[model samples]
Target: MFTLNSQSSVGHNRARTMPTSSAPRLLFLCFTLLSHFHSSVATPRHLRLSVQDIATVEAAQPARHRAKAKTTFFEVDRPLHPPRGSSGPCSTLLLSHSFALTLTKPPVTTAYSPPSCLRGAGDVSLAVLEWRADCHGVQYDRIFGVWLGGAELLRGSTAEPRPGGVTWSVHKDVTKYTSLLATGNSTLAVYLGNLIDDTYNGIYYANLTLHLYFHRKAQSAPTPAASAPADLIVPVSRSQPLDDGLWFVVQNGTDVESTRVTVPANAYRAVLEVYVSSHYSDEFWYMNTPDQNGPFREVTVQLDGDVVGAVWPFPVIYTGGINPLIWRPITSIGSFNLPTYDIELTPFLGKLLDNKEHEVGFAVTNAQNSWYVNANLHLWLDPKASTTAGGLISHDAPKLAGGINSHSLDGIDGEYRATASRNISATGWVSSSRGNITTTFAQRLNFANTNVVSKNGSEQTINQTIDAHTEVGGGGAYAHQLHHSFPLYIFLGGNGSGTSSQRLMRKVQIGFVESRSGAVAGTSTLRNEQVAEAVVVLRDDQVAGASWRMHQVYNYGASNGACYVRNVTSVGYDVLFDHDEASCGGTARR
Candidate 1:
C-alpha cells in the first residue's frame, strides 16, 4: 500500500524499525447506437496515435528559454544506449541505458497563469536527475518519481553507487507547480523502486533534465523602481482541492487520518504539507518499527491537536569494504533525501482561512503503531484587507491521562529493567489582523531499558534509552519559532557461544524562528541538526549461525540555516513542534 512517487517531494524495506514500507487503461468509444437502417449507410471512425503515443505527444512540449542554450535529452526519438563496459564514474549513458518520456508542457512563459500565489515567486525552472554508479549489485535507495497531468511532480532519494563512475544527482524546483504548470499537458512518468527484481543484480543508471531558467520578464521597470516600501498586495482566493496535493494512510491502532480544508475565498496566507511515512509502520508485527535487530527511529508530528515537527532520520551506514549498492534494496536505510515532516501552518492560518469548513487532522504518537501520511493545504488571501477571521482563541490538549506507562524490573543472580512514558500538551490561539496568534506547545517522553539473560543459556546484554522534548509557537500573519531535541542510546551484546556486539543511535536538534508584521514584515532563522552513530564490535572464531568479528564505526551529520529581516524596524516571531522519542529495547540475539 505504498505507491507514492507520482511526483511530490520537498522530500523503504527495512529490518530495523518496522511499521510501513500499481496500471493501465485507455479505450475511447462514441457509439453509433443501433440506427442500422436509413440514418447511416456508412460509418467509419479513425483515430490512430501510437509510436509510443506519438513520442508521448512530442515529449509533452513547453520547456523553452533558448537564446542559445543546449544540453537536451528527455527524449530524442527514443531507443538509446551506448557504453556497457562500465568504466570509472560510470556514465556513457550509464553502462548502457533505458529511455522513456512524456510530460506535456510545464516550463511556462507566454503568459502562463493558474498559480494564484500561495507562495511561488520565480518559476526560475530547474529539473535534474542524473545517475552513473552501476553499484554492482545495488540494494534499495533508488526511488525517483516525477509525474504530471495525472498528479505528483517530483519526489526524492536516488543516486547511491560510487564505485568510481560517480554521478548521482537529484534536484527539482520546477517552480513549485505553477498551478500544475500554467495550462495543460502533463503525462510524464518515471519510477524506479527498490527491493530489486534482480535485473542483472545491483543495477541502476540514469539521466533526465530540464533547466530553462526563463528570464524575459524584466523589461518594463528597468531603473525607476527604488521607492523603498510596499507590502500590501492582497487578492487571493483558493479552495477546491487546491490542485490535488493530499494523500493519506495510517495503520493499526484504529487508523486515524481525516481531511477538510476550506478557509479560502479570501484567506490571508497558509501552507501545509506535513508528509509522514514511517515507511508504513516499519514493516509489521503490526506497527512501531525499526529494530530489525535494534535502534533507529525518531519522529513527531500532530496537527489539529497541534505539536508540528520533530525528526531524526538518516541511518544509512554500511562500511564493510565493498558495497553491493546498499546490500540489496531494503528501505535504502534512511535519508537519501526522501525526507518529510515539514510544517508551516501560519499559526493556524489566521484562524484557519475564515471562509469556513476546517478540520485538517493528523496524528503519530507511539500508541498502536502504524503510520503513512501525506497532508497538503496551501493558501493565501486578504479578503479585501484581511480582518482575520476566527477559531481556536483558547484551547489545551492534555489527555493521555491513561496510556503507555509500562514497568518491569528484577534482580537476583542477574539484573533487569524496562520503563516507558509519553507526555503531551497542546496550547492555543487564533485571531490575527494584528496580534493574538498565540500558539504554545509542550512535550516530554522518556523510555529506559537494561537486560541480562543467562541461567545456563550463556550470554546477552541490552541497554536502550530515549528522551524527547518539543516546543512550538506562533503569533499572527508571520512569526514562528520551534525547538526540538532528541536523545537516544542503544547497545547490543551476544552469546550462546556466538560473538558480536553493536551500538546504534539517532539524534536531532532543531531551532527555528520567523518574523513578520505588516507590509511583508521580515526576520527568518533556522538551525537544523541531525546525527547518526553506529559502532560494531565482534571477536569471531569464524562459523556459528554466521561468523562474527565486528569492528565497524560510522557517524552521520546534517545542518540547515535561514534568514530574513523585512518589517522595517519592528519585531516578530513564530514556532511549531511535534514529538516522538522514548523507546526502550529488548530483542537482538542471533
Candidate 2:
C-alpha cells in the first residue's frame, strides 16, 4: 500500500511546528533514558491458480510430481553449523505434519516425546529445528512463532504468497534448548495467524521437525565453555496463553510489557534473550518525521524498577515492506528468521535469589502504534551449592545523549538530522560453588540518522547507521565480546507529473555486520549486504507497469574452518545469476 499521503501530512505538520528563524541549526531534544541500557529459488513459469485449485492439483498429483512442481523461495544465508565429523547417531521427531493454520483455528499443539533411542541418553550434542511451509493465492506476510514448554524457540515471518504458490524452509540451531527438549511430555505449539476472506484466501500449510544429534565417544573437537547451554530455561512471557504467541503489544513509549519470574536458588548466571517486531504506524520508523519524535527508538530492559540494559534494534524490513514487487524471490536479510538480542542479567541475580518473585519488564522509548515484545530467561545453576548469594556492586546508566534537529523546512520540503549515544556498565560478586566470583558487564551504542524531503514530499531519502559493542568478563570465565553495525539507505520518489501519469521509483541499500568472540562459541563473523531498485507506473492507484532488480551478497566464517559465501542477482521474478563459494577470505574487510 502507498503511504505518500500520510508521509506528506506528517512533513507538513513538522514544518509548521518549526521556528520561523532562518538559522540552519534548530535542535529538538527529547531524550528519556529510563531504559537500562538498554531468498530465492525456483522456476520461471507464471501460472494463475486459486488456493483450492492449487491444493487439489497437488493432492491429485503423484508425490514425485508434486515435489518437482513445487518451487522454494529462500534468503541466502549460512546453514546451521552442527558438530563436525560423524554426529554419532541422530533421531528425527515430527512436531507437526502438514498442519493447516488460519485465523479462526487455535495453534497446533502436540506432546513432545524423546526418541526411544535417546530415552535416557545424556550425550545429546545438538538439536536442530526444521520448518517448511507452502502457500498459494494472494496473502499478506504474517508473523509466526514456535514454542516448547511455553518458552519460545523460533520466531519468524511467512512469505507473501503468489498465484503460482511458493514453498520455503528454515533450519535453526536449537542446541541451546537441549534441556527443554529433553523433558518428557512437554507441549510443543506452533502459531501462524492468517486470514481467509474474499480477497485474501491463502492458507498456510506447515510441517515442523526436530533433529537431535548425539556426541561420538571420540570427538574431533571439544565444545567451548561459553557455548554451554543454560541448565534451566524460564519463559518471561504471559502465562496461561499457550494458544497464541505470548508476546505483549506496546502502543506507545509509556507502555511496559513485563512478567514476574523467580529463579532457582542455586542459579549463578542469568541472561535475557529478547524478540521484537514493529507493525502499523511504526513499520517505517526510520522515515518518521523528526518533529514527531524523529526516527529514534530503543528497547529498554528493567529489573524491578531499575533499568538494567537497552537494545537499539536492527531495522528489519518485512517481505511486504515498501514495494512488495522487489521482494518476490529474495526477501530482506532478517525477514525469514528475525535475529534476537541478548542482555546479560547476571549482575541482577543477587536480587532474584531470595526465593521470591521479581519483575522483569520491557518498554520502547519512543514507540508508537504497535510493537510486539517478549523474552526468555536462561539461568545456569551451581551444582555444588543449594543456594547462592550475591550483590550488585555498581550500576552506571545515564540518560540518552543527542536528539533531533531541524536544519531547514519549507512546505513539506525539509531536512532533519538525529543522533544518540549511550553507555552502560554493571558489576557484581556472587558466592557460589566456585567461590566468590566477580562479574562485570559493559555496553556502548551510537546512532545517527538523516532524513531529506524535497519536491513537495514526492522525493524522500533516509540515511541511518547504528554501531554497538558489548563485553562480559571476570569470574574466571572466558571474556565474551560482541560487535555489530547496521547501515541503511533508502530513496523513494516519484515523477513530478500528474497522478494519472505518475511514475514511482524506490532504491534501497542495507547491511548487517556482526562479530562475536570468546566463550565456548569461539570466534565468528557475518556480513550480509543487499542493494535493490524498483520502478512502477501507477494510474489512479492501479499498477500499469512495474520492474525491479536486486543483488545480494552474504559471507560467514568461524574459527572452526566453517566458511560460506553466496551472491545472487534477480530481475522481476527471474534469477539471473546465482553463485556459491566456500571461501571466507577478505570477508572481514567488507
Candidate 3:
C-alpha cells in the first residue's frame, strides 16, 4: 500500500524567455503574496504523535502503518508559461521516488479547449492513462497533472499524438515534451490508472510528484510590426468672446478650445491621428508659445514613434511669429522627457471650447520652457464654416492694415497703402565744382495711389518725388523755378574755369549698411525722417565676378539716408528682366 502527502503553491504570467539569476521577479512576488495569504499555520497534526504512542499504533496496525502512514514529497520545477495568453508548448519531465518512472506502455488522452483565466489551460491535456508491470504481477501509475486554469486530470487508455501535435517522451532519467498550440487555444492531460488491473495484488497511490522539465517551445508567438508617421495641430480661438468664464485665453495661436482639458503637472506627449491631405512629409512645427501676436520662436518636434530627421519638407514655419528662434527637429529618444516644458509660459496657457459640432480632443502637454507642461486641448471643424476662418482644414487670410492720406475707409480692401500731400516754398543754395549756383523755387505736390499691392499682398501704394534745379552765370544771383516730383530731392549746377584741367578716371566704389528689427507682423512706423540715398551705377558697370555689399534690410524695409547714398552706389541690376542698369541719386546722410 502507498499513500502520499503534498504541498501546493500557485503562480502566474511567468517569463518564457528562459529564467536567469535566482527566482523570477514575478515568481518571487507571487510567493511573497502567497506567504502573506498562508502566514498563520502550523505543521501537519500527524507529526504531533509521541514516540510511545507512535510505537503502540505501529505495532497494532503493522501492515497499515508500514504503508498508509508513509509520507512522500516531490517537486516539479520549470519557468512559468505565458501569464494570460496561450504558451506555445514546451517539453517537461516527471520524476518520482528518485526512480526513472518509465511509461511502461503508451497512454490514452482526451483533449478540449481549456477555459480562460487559467495559465496554459488551452495548452494542457485533461487526463491521460498509463500502466506498467512490476515483480508484483502488473503495476500501474495514475499520473495527474494540476493546472491553475480550468482542468481535471483523469485516467485513460493509450492514444497516439494528433497531427502536428507535440509529443512527450519518457527518458531513462529525464523526459522531453512539446506543446502543440503555438498561437491559440491549448489542452493538457495526465495519465491516470490503477497501479495494477489485478486490484488486490497491486499498489495504488492517490498523490505523487510528476516533475516538470521545461523544454523551449518549437516556435514563439510572433510580435506585431511597427507603424507609420503623422501629426495633428488643433486650433482654438482665444478671442475674448469665447473666453466665457470657464476658459482663459492664455495665448492667441492654438488649435485647441477652452473648457476642453485640464492642466496636469507633468504632461509631455500628445497623440494625434491625422490624415495627411498632401503627400508631402514636412517637418512639423508648433507654435512654441501662446502669443498669436508675437516675435515667436520654434522648437523641434517629433511624434508617432517617428524620428524626425535633419531635413524634411515644408521649410518649418512656427506660425506664431517672424523672428523664429531655436527651430530644429527632435532626432533622438532621450529627448522625449515628459514635462520638459512649462504651460504657464507656453502658448497653451488657455482653455478649450467644447462646441459639439466640431472634431475635438485635449492636449497632454504645452512644452513651453519645461520638458512637459500639461495643458488642455480642444478642437473642432465644420464644412459649413467660413473657408477663410482659421480651422484645421481652412486657410485663413493674412491680416490687413490701413494706409495714410486717403481716408482709412478707402484702403479698407486690406492691402498695404499710403498717401502723402505736402506744400513746399523755399529758397535754396548749392555749390558746384567751381562756384555757387544760387536758386529759389516754390512748389506743392499731392500724391496718392490705391489698389496698393505690397511685395506680399497689400491694398495701397504711395509714390512721392520732387525735382528742383538752378543755373549760375555773370557773377550775379538769379532765381530759377525747378519743378520736381519725387519722394525727396535737391540739385546743383555750376561751370568751372579751366577745360580738361583734371580728368578723373572711371572708379567703382561700393558701400554697405546693416539694419535690425523685431519680426512683428504689422507695419512698423518710420523711426527716422531721413531715407537711403545712393549714386546710380549702371548694371554693365558692376565689375564681373566682384561681390557687392547689399543692404541688410531690417525686417524687410530700407532704412533712410545713412548707407546707400551715392550715385553709382545706389545702382541695382534688374536681375529679373536681365541685367539692366537701375539707379538712384543722393548721399548717405541719416
**Top-lDDT structure, candidate number:** 2
Candidate 2 lDDT over residue span 1-590, tens digit each: 22222211101111112223221121336533221110010010111122333233235434543443545678777766556554634656566544333443456778787766564324667777888889876566777878888788888788766556788888888888877877778878776766656766667788787877777668645544446788889988765444445677666777788889999999888999998877655677777664334588888898997788988989887766666666768888888788899999888778889999999999887776557788889988887889999999999988878877664434456676789899999998778877788888888999999887777656778899999999998863746899989999988777945656667788889999999897656798999999998877666654455678999999888897888988889886678888777655543221
Ten-residue region with minimum lDDT total, candidate 3? 319-328
Candidate 1, which segments miss by more than 4 Å at Cα? 1-269, 272-326, 329-337, 342-347, 351-378, 382-388, 399-590
TM-score, each model? 0.29, 0.85, 0.14
**Candidate 3: regions farther than 4 A off:** 1-67, 75-106, 118-590
- TM-score: model 1 vs. ground truth: 0.29
lDDT of 1 at 255: 44
Per-residue lDDT tens digits of candidate 3, residues 1-590?
Answer: 01111111000001122122121121101111111211121111111212222223223333432443222110111112232333333332221221123223212222433223224412232112122211221121122221111112111111111111111222111110112121134323332222222221223222222222222345433221111011112322122211011112111122222222232322111222111100001111111101111111112122122111001011111100110000001001111110111111111111111122322322212111111111222111222322111111111112112123212222222222233233322222222232332322222333332222222221112222222221111221222122222231111111221332211111111111112322222122211111221121112322111111112111113333222211111112111111111122422332
Query: Candidate 1: minimum summed lDDT over ten consecutive residues — where?
Result: 566-575
Cα lDDT tens digits for candidate 1, 1-590? 10111111111322234343100000111122122211211110011111222122223323431112321111001111211321122111211233111112122112223323212223222222233223433233333444444334444444433222223443444434434444433233444443334321345555544332322343322211111111121111112232112234344333446655466544444445444444322321111111121122334445554544434332222211111111112112223334333344444554555566665555433323334454445454442454565444433334322112212122212323444445554444545444445655444555444443333322223344444444445544343333332222222223333324322111111112112222122323222222122221223431111111111111111121122111111000010111211111222221
